[model samples]
Target: MRRFERIHDIVEPVEGYRRGGYHPVHLHDIYNQRYEIIGKLSHGQFSTVWLAYDRLLQQHVALKTLKADASKNNKELSTLRHLSATNPDHPGKRHVLELLDYFEHDGPNGTHLCLVLPVMVSDGEGMTVNGKSHEATYVRSISKQILLGLDFLHTLSIVHCDLQPANIMVSTEAAAHSETFLQPPEFNPARWLKGMTADESAPNYLIATQRRRGQLDSADWSELSVKIGDLGGGGREGNHRKSVAPTALRVPELIHQNKTWNASIDAWALGCLICELATNEPLFPLGIFGLSAEQIDHEHLSLIGGLLDGDGQINETFVKHLTDRLPPDFGAENIQHLASFLGLMLQQDPLKRMSTVELLKHPFLVGDIEG
Candidate 1:
């Protein structure tokens, strides 16, 4: 019998794996006879997420599978464990995804690490019920929740390197009544490990992969809560990984490749995310330039570069007057307050950016503010 590898041995950002050439798990294929695959949720660079039903708990779950060979020392499992132990004190704060269970399974791709997570819905559910923009109140509420989640992570010195729209999911009341039918795989880890690693067993009718996509009803949007998902790019304060947020959401510090950055980088990302949520469009549509990576960096700097005065400290006057420079869409209602908040979050210098703890206390979080 082969022994399971130690958890600490796994590292973040495993390389060399791709979405193609991997083994396929059939419909109704159950692992340990505990989780039955209902549908494929999505695929990533090194793993595939499947929507499954928990036979023991009788609830829906998202199962993420990572090829064991490519998954050395999985950091996400450890991060979830640490977060669970830390336990944020806010009762209403359900902004982070909860890890229910995890185990190893052998497939045609060799051994795979499977993580059981709660299924998530879309975030834009109820905001546009009337077809007008999402009100400032709803935007404030969601932003507060995201800040609280960030505060929890920053308190523990963890940096969520990615915080894009895709990583933020919404949970709705309707999901409780949803149901699906699927068959379960027979329990036998040893047998599956010794099982064939070829793709010949795949059913002719089955597609190699399926994508799970969802949209929320406008009425349900108000009842929806946001949770930050996908911590695969996250790590302890100084892990030094390249390219944190998605291109459009990338902060100056990350774009500059400064290795000394800490949790404040997340502040920049949260700022960009909040702007998009408020405007229903990307804060910085860097793709419009369509330049190479180096040129794109310059374009980003040009937008926020003026925040830095000759002395290099944050120009209080510059950020204070940001409303004049920013477009009207950011504020829709309370322009001054929103512009000030974005200024604080989008500081050109990482050190000058507001910490999550400080950002949570800003006037913007409470209500509208004067410049």
Candidate 2:
């Protein structure tokens, strides 16, 4: 009895958290040893991503600094670990974002967990791989790489809940570290230029002209590689939102109160974003505060929904799952522009919607001249 009690004491504490919480990892909180938190780039509900420098490896990386919300962080860590494990054998998991190191930091409120991500290109916002701003080509490059990343995640039965230009990064040999820099170089505003210089434009280019290359260069898009991110909303879904896109670049099932959403939802969002990127505009420009193109954040959704709905009289039971109310009167005409393309992706019925794999084969992407 005493021996069992002794054994129980030793095992209980270990099992309590190592099993109940955390990523089954025991790592250091040292900055220089592992990574140097450079600056805060973006913040999410549970984590703040950092522009970090890896001292050991000596490279620039984006670090997801998680605020220990307890519930949220625990969930993210476990899922990432699970994906990393199950993903090893999955064909889709190959060469995505390789988990380099895990660590924690002391915070005023509590301890914060962090994940280090490799920095691709600084061409986010309007920036481009060439340091100058361009369009079309950059959009195609971003879309194709994102597709590759999604394809891998889909193979593992994972749906990246959140994917956007802000989440995707550009990877290129030209973008690689120069050994001394050992990180994605910090862009100098004054140094930003347009088009390659004379000699460099051909073969033996001048070093000075390299930075000014066009932002929309086909190379930017061609060099795109993807890394699926922010699984906070990531998961498998049942059919529901087929009739609508979710509030945030969502599919119909997601918006129509879907019970089961899957890779298709992710595909739907990806397509919409690609459409917006292609035009250098928001597919659903209505800001979170501002809804559809007609204004009013949640007006009729008619304009948005019209792109997908047809016949005006499909079975209500079939669509009731997608939405509870009739969408706003988008007039007799439907949104045939980008929304129409997105409409096909948001096919309320999962069977009808395009799968991530299928989307990769679409003419919208596959037939890209620039890509």
Candidate 3:
């Protein structure tokens, strides 16, 4: 059997955008349909998400336009298609956001994969999730949703290497007119065109307008489904020679030493994702990319000392890869106690890391799941 490679190992982004003019699938003369492209919904390391609308659906959807990386694209599409087929009744993979449609197109940049998904619009920033009875309420819901997804994937023995908020979507459930997205008179095309550029005023300005797409309701979803997007770093069982885990969400043992982990690896990521939602900040709290290992340094057995059975050099495999491996003071200076609760989850040892199975059923999340 081959050994698993330490993941997040790409020293640089792949260069592949030179070839252009990729075209997407258009059903029912979609090119002629009236749709609008809103500003960015979310942007990640390799893709940008756009909030768009369809004149026919009269609803908002998310359009993810990925950069040109053919090798990664083909791999991602395979997983996405599998997930899509499973939840013929659910989008967003039956967890958070609903997956709508998949389209491949050629553009000025290069070949692109456009994913249409449901939109979770917010009156405020950071998933203004509507219900905020308490901080733990948010923490609990977010955690359980993520854990449920992790648990589901574990059954298939697949790990979502990249698990973060920019990759997450809250549920858009029970929306009132005021809560929903509709183009008001103030935002209508007729009035929105008044301030167009002088060049846009040309007779066929619309003919030159950027191609506008529409909202895609693939199968219609109601519950808050949590779906893991971005398979760029994913791999099946065996053939572990390739790298797949994202550094930030990585378990100390897994990322640092090339240790093979099962679904439990995602439990660590689930804890981190919930921490971000609870505090509205990243759990690991990264600096620039180069300084990442230092940011998540898992040294000295300090973080998970009590949890490990053989406390010798816990996370030793993971800590050695970093530029620096000094043990954190773990006091007021090194780590803050924003949610003293999170300390229970971010354990240094993968086995000691908070288990999503136990976590989701915990009192913190159990009540909220009911709520």
Q: What is the lDDT of residue 225 in candidate 3?
A: 42
Which prediction has more favorable lDDT, 1 or 3?
Answer: 1
Model 2 segments beyond 4 Å from truth? 1-32, 70-73, 87-95, 123-140, 176-219, 237-248, 287-300, 306-343, 364-371
Task: Rank by TM-score, highest first.
Answer: 1, 2, 3
Question: Which residues of candidate 1, in runs, are more than 4 Å off?
Answer: 1-23, 88-93, 123-132, 176-214, 220-222, 288-290, 306-333, 368-371
TM-score for all models, in order of appearance: 0.76, 0.61, 0.59
Candidate 2's error at 369, in angstroms? Answer: 3.3
**Alpha-carbon shift of residue 142 in model 2 (angstroms):** 3.0
Superposed model 3: Cα runs more than 4 Å off: 1-36, 56-58, 70-73, 87-93, 122-134, 174-228, 237-248, 286-347, 352-358, 367-371
What lDDT score belongs to each candidate, Candidate 1 first? 0.64, 0.48, 0.45
Model 2, residue 229: what's the lDDT?
A: 61
Question: On residues 1-371, what C-alpha lDDT tens digit does candidate 3 reach at each position?
Answer: 11112223221111211233122111122322433565444444556555666567777666766665652446666766666556444221466333567676555455677777666543112442322222333444455666676655554556666566656654445431121343311111211223433221111101111211121122132333444555655666453433454455666666466646655455666656665555444445434445445545543223434333243232433233111221222122112221222444556555655555565555554432221
Q: Would you list the rank order by lDDT, best first? A: 1, 2, 3
Candidate 1 vs candidate 2, lDDT winner: 1
Worst 10 residues of 1 by lDDT: 9-18
Worst 10-residue stretch by lDDT in candidate 3?
Answer: 200-209
